[model samples]
Target: MAVSALVHLVTGGLVVGGALLIVLGWETIVQPVLGLFLIFLAAELRPRFGKVDEERLLRRAGVPRLFALLDDIAEAVGTRGFDAVRLTQDFAISAVPFGLRRRRLDIGLALWETLTPQQRIACPARARGHFAAGDVRHNLMVRTALPP
Candidate 1:
């Protein structure tokens, strides 16, 4: 099994075991109430489907050079390309994967415009690496399971 799945299993088991100990060891009336609350909390933690705004999708921009740079960077990182590019105001570049097979290359317009050609290529390259590596921080399930 994958290490990611194993981590989740261990975490889930620990939580459930702790809850069972609390329910079984405690003889107070609130024990059942706390158990029910834990159940509801667990139920609420199911990963939800992600939705992207179609309006933010980039069909084409006037900057051919930027697009070419993007193509080169993507090739360097071994990804086919982004399905869509989403412009953001956050001043950070990231790859956002939504649904099953769709990915959005999130470009922070403020930072993109300020970066040098080489820096622009570098930033996206790291984001691509994150997406490609199945990094824990980049996994939606892992992200959702942890507390913010």
Candidate 2:
């Protein structure tokens, strides 16, 4: 957390200083270019989750069968359960916690459709396991410190 804060502070300072140099009418093209680069870096410094989009989110009513399958998996895996479900075209399955009790599950349709039934079960189980394993890459603080 401290590292992320320090990084943000330094990046903010660079952005401000660069903008000031450009505002003051620097003698060379270097100042403007550097300013633009710093601004871009600031924009890409942290990844943010977008607003909830219902169209992409799977509702239990809309996919009760799929939800049932997940529930069975969750029970077997000994996890509480997922609160939200998202479908993605990318070939990946991941879960991220939000707001203490809620976990958002992102299911990649491409890989899902290609897997065998047994493999399909294993995929999500593995994703949940990754989170349970306490991987540093999954930490919010470390994630914020990384560039998008």
Candidate 3:
């Protein structure tokens, strides 16, 4: 009889202990852990979920300098005969080969937001052609990427 009572008491204690652990864990660990996980998930997804405007980008990067730089590039390449250059924060720049043998230099303004500083500075360095024709071609490519 005593052994049975001890067994029962031990079983009862274990049951109570398990219940307390569940309650304490839920309050102090599980709920807050899940909440923090959700916050981190939102932060990681924010960029893909967020919307960015071109004017806002230009304002952040200094509009006048960007315009003058584009202008200087146009004149340096002697492609001023092309249409008037317009500043925009729409499109990214990359170097591409246009000729049959892939030896010709062509800079592409990708169909996305404007050049990041690295691409903007590096693209012209990758270009080669008769300065005037190359400038005209480069501007045409950029214009084509723009909306109608």
What's each prediction's TM-score?
A: 0.60, 0.59, 0.24
Ranking by TM-score: 1, 2, 3
For residue 8, model 2's alpha carbon misses the true position, in angstroms, by: 5.6
Query: Positional deviation of 59 in candidate 2, in angstroms?
Result: 2.3
Better of 1 and 3 by TM-score: 1
Q: What is the C-alpha lDDT profile of model 3 across 30-110, one tens digit per residue?
A: 655555554454344221211223232333135566545655665665543111222333353333322221222223445
Give Cα distance to truth, residue 81, candidate 2, Å.
1.8
| Alpha carbon lDDT of each predicted model | 0.71, 0.73, 0.40
> Model 2: which ten-residue window has the lowest total lDDT?
45-54
Q: Rank the candidates by lDDT, best first.
A: 2, 1, 3
Among all candidates shown, the one with the greatest TM-score:
1
Candidate 2: tens digits of C-alpha lDDT, residues 1-148: 6777787687788778768767875788888888888777767763443346667788778889888887777777777567678989989888865443456789899988999989988887777775667766556655556654
Question: Compared with the true structure, what per-residue lDDT tens digits does model 1 show for residues 17-43?
Answer: 558856695778677667666656655
Which candidate's lDDT is highest? 2
Give me the runs in candidate 2 sitting further than 4 Å from their true place: 8-52, 96-101
